[model samples]
Target: TMAGTGAGYDLSTTTFSPDGRVFQIEYAMKAVDNSGTCLGLVCKDGVLVAVEKFLLSKMLVEKTNKRIFPVSRHAGMASAGLVTDARQIVQRARDEARVHTENFGEKIAPHVLAERTAGFVHLFTLYGSVRPFGS
Candidate 1:
């Protein structure tokens, strides 16, 4: 268990609890798990993304809702975590995809986009000031 707010073990991501658990990392993983599932598939035909809607409201219109988005003509994504954090990743993916097309004259691969997103997310874990993104 977390001993206290100022405990040495609780301060660094490299520190592990008595049970051999990194509390901060586990907490971040749990946050993502609490969100609904996001279905994504890549095949010879195209890329597809689906998200389970949770905050349905009578006054809210479907037209305003924009979860799944097209990164490019052939690629898009739907996320299941913090919307702001997810948007940060989505915007980065869009930038990468655009740069790929501009340089290589081909649409970016889904796996490449996923790898870049993962790499970006990795930073939060290693750095102290930046907290891990739940998305």
Candidate 2:
């Protein structure tokens, strides 16, 4: 059965009623669900990630890959769909980490990076032409 989209909901990031709900975010989430799979593992030694690779052909030359990426010395992330979007988020995270260390004289912790980046992601869903990141 098909799921019902909420009534009177406008599927645009710029529009919202008094209820303050954005159905466009829901739609973006559904789109993200169709992206590739990515897995992350943390053990005693360090962090490891296994990501899905979609190789088009044997002759396609390798450029910069968009799968696993590093945010800071202590933090990294692996993304599936819209890896370009993920790179933007990662760049934001990296900048935040740098500002944190420059101001506090300490490395940004992984949990802290995650928390701040999550808020950044939420802001994109609330306004502008920005859509949700698939990672």
Candidate 3:
């Protein structure tokens, strides 16, 4: 699905079961105008969160900055709207996870990490009036 066009935000959920042995699910929420606000959840052995920022056609030509945030230790996060904000959130999540690991020494669960990421998104929404961008 294409989201963040001139159309309003779109939300969708998809599930995949491969050979009936493994179950995977993905949930996505996207904003209007391609301003690039969105969230994605990937569920495999665990859950991974991804966010993206919006990019203007002109900005795409410059190629000065690119999205590079790790969603989990084994995954990455990206978004389509407000690139700076999405980057900031990813950086903060990495720092927070590092600190938590240092203090807990690997006791943290994947679900907890997912929750933390969601909490950050929630806080951002509470403080700002921006939507997510994606498909």
Ranking by lDDT: 1, 2, 3
Off by over 4 Å in 2: 1-11, 14-23, 56-60
TM-score of each: 0.75, 0.76, 0.47
lDDT tens per residue, model 3, 1-135: 432432222222122233331111111232223444445656776755543434456647655455546655754665554466667677767766787789988735657766787787665333224432221
Displacement of the residue 124 alpha carbon in candidate 3, Å? 3.2
Whole-model lDDT, model 1? 0.75
Candidate 2, lDDT over the whole model: 0.75
Expressed as tens digits, the lDDT of each residue in 108-132 for candidate 1 is 8879888987888898888666677
Q: What C-alpha lDDT values do all the predictions have?
A: 0.75, 0.75, 0.49
Sort every candidate by TM-score, greatest first. 2, 1, 3
User: Cα lDDT of model 3 overall?
Assistant: 0.49
